[model samples]
Target: MRPETKEITTESLGVLETAALLRELTAGLIASSDFDAALAQLARTSRDAIPGVSWCGVTVLRAGEPASVATSDVHRSDLDRLQYGADGPAMTAIRQREMILAEDLRRETRWPRWTRRALALGVHGVLSAPVDIDDQVIGSINLYSGRPGVLTASRQLTAMLLAEHAGLLLAAVRDRARQSELAGELDETLAGGEVIGQAIGVIMTQRRCSAQDALQVLRSASAALSLPLREVSERLVGSAARPRG
Candidate 1:
């Protein structure tokens, strides 16, 4: 869903200008290398692009992991307390996979603790949008304001757009990281198999031994050298693959 856009400046930006900025923002996110960088970028973007946003931060909730908060300008001690939790608007957005807003904290009864704390910190309202990094991770972008109703419909849409951009970039990074990890595992597995096979070939040719016997030889070498069998086999196979003058 496309969220509405808002201009933070005194002179509001036009629709075309806003669209261009959003395109540029997503392009930047596509190029970001890590989620941390993306989070920082999104936080900064929200603070600049959305109207009535005093503070911004990201809540990351990866499956099977603890929640973490990446604050852009939520440095106030009271605001910092919201970094980890499942009850706030940010968490609600992630859980519901939709936009959640607290127009006035004093009237908010859904999350009593968060509302009380936020009210104490001079934050009268908030807008949160789900930032799903694929199905395994849940996240949200939260916009905090000092005035009730400051995050109006337009501003909330802008914040939602920012959150979605963040989700897109984070999902890409998460997928890429997982792919790299899988590649590493595959490479290791293939290398081990190749080394063991090559060692067997060398033993068969030089020692006239069967594959099982060659494997036993490798085991013996590993025990004597205090190395893993794969390491010993890798060394043996590597030396054989090299040409000696």
Candidate 2:
């Protein structure tokens, strides 16, 4: 038989335990290897962690465009529509860098198109929190529920905390990836430097020219060919190493 699992709810856990739960959830979000994976896990973990969150997802913003990155619901295209259409609480939260709420879509007058679609889908309420990194808004974490009044004061506080944790985790993940990319670039640069040095040595010996003159020749060739300095140097090195035939 399958093991009976119990829901870990805020009501069941005391203050200290709740803190630990939040930490564990935060750690889980950070444990992902990449930002994409982190966001995907965050959707599921936050839905499980935040009370009264029927659906949870992330909206990644770029160049003032909102894109649905991850979602807990199977029919998550709801978020995609809201993003592409550019009218939803998530977009509002991202713009304002604050929480946005639509307590009742049926009675909502702020966004008629969104309210109609949301009502049709049985999503009566929506709570969105801005995901910020270094005080800069990058996106939003959104929750949709069937109930009209979902995010009470206590829930809002918890959702904000979760959004902050997710934002920090994503930032760390992106930073790590950027560091790795820079490291790889450095390695390539060093290798290119070595090859360029070899090519310069070849030119100096063949033409009895100075190192500076040889480098100038290589640079001219690179400029004329519209190729990178590294590529030109690499080709020169290869030509010198080729067996006479």
Candidate 3:
């Protein structure tokens, strides 16, 4: 017989235990370098922290497209993909930005296609909590169980907490990536400006003309050659540095 779902109260998970869980999750998130890695850590940690959860998966919007970023087991990727192929809890949770729960796949009438496939995969209960990364980006942290009624109220709370932390960590990762990109552009701009100044100085000396005239000459050459101003400046500077031959 299938074991009855355990309905443990939230009180069973005390303040101290919750604090320890937060610490562990913080360490896991800090060790991750990107959104995928951080969410994968949460999936793995949730499976161990929650009593009834047999596996976990995470789905998010990548470049405005839905993607399954993490799963506890390799085989579970099919289960998440099946949900994407049709309307299911993970997508529903993300769209509505709310929690979605199916107490038992056998009795679930909301998503027929997803339910049928989940039942075949031996997943009976599912709970999805939305992760709010930003105004434009949202996702879901999904918990799966092998028996009906295993997704208790307390476990749902735990899943919600984990999703919240995932959102914050993912936002940090995005911010870091944006910062790095901006820094690269800034460095390129400074280097290009320096080279352009050198080229202008060389032109001024060669033509015995004003700085403005030197810049105009460089611009005219750039337009005639159909090259970027930076490229033209780099070529001119390189040619000027060469010894007479």
lDDT top scorer:
3
Top candidate (TM-score): 3
Model 1 residue pairs with clashes = none
- Candidate 2 lDDT over 1-245, as tens digits, reads 33333343435564554576578777776555566677778888877766677888788765554454788876854763454326778788877888887776777887777777777767888888988754333888888887887755556767777787777888887778778866864665477888888888989999999998997888788779998668988898898899999
lDDT of 3: 0.79
Cα deviation in Å at residue 40, candidate 1? 2.3
* Residues 1-245 of candidate 1: C-alpha lDDT, one tens digit per residue: 22333334323554555676587678767765566677777777776666678888778776787666767665543443344345788778877888988888888889887777788778898888887678788778888888997876666566666666667778887777777766764664466787777887888888998887877787678679998667877888888979999
In model 3, pairs of residues that clash are none
Clashing pairs in 2: none
Off by over 4 Å in 2: 1-21, 63-68, 80-85, 135-137, 189-193, 196-245
Candidate 2 has an lDDT of 0.74
The order of the candidates by TM-score, greatest first, is 3, 2, 1
Estimated TM-score for each candidate: 0.65, 0.68, 0.69
User: What is the descending lDDT order?
Assistant: 3, 2, 1
10 residues in a row with least lDDT, candidate 1: 1-10
lDDT of each: 0.73, 0.74, 0.79
lDDT of each residue in 1-245, candidate 3, tens digit only: 33332323434445556667677877887645566677788788777777788998878776566674688987766666644424888888887888898887898898888778788888999999999887667778889999999896766767777788778887877677677766764665467898988998999999999998987898788779998778999999999999998
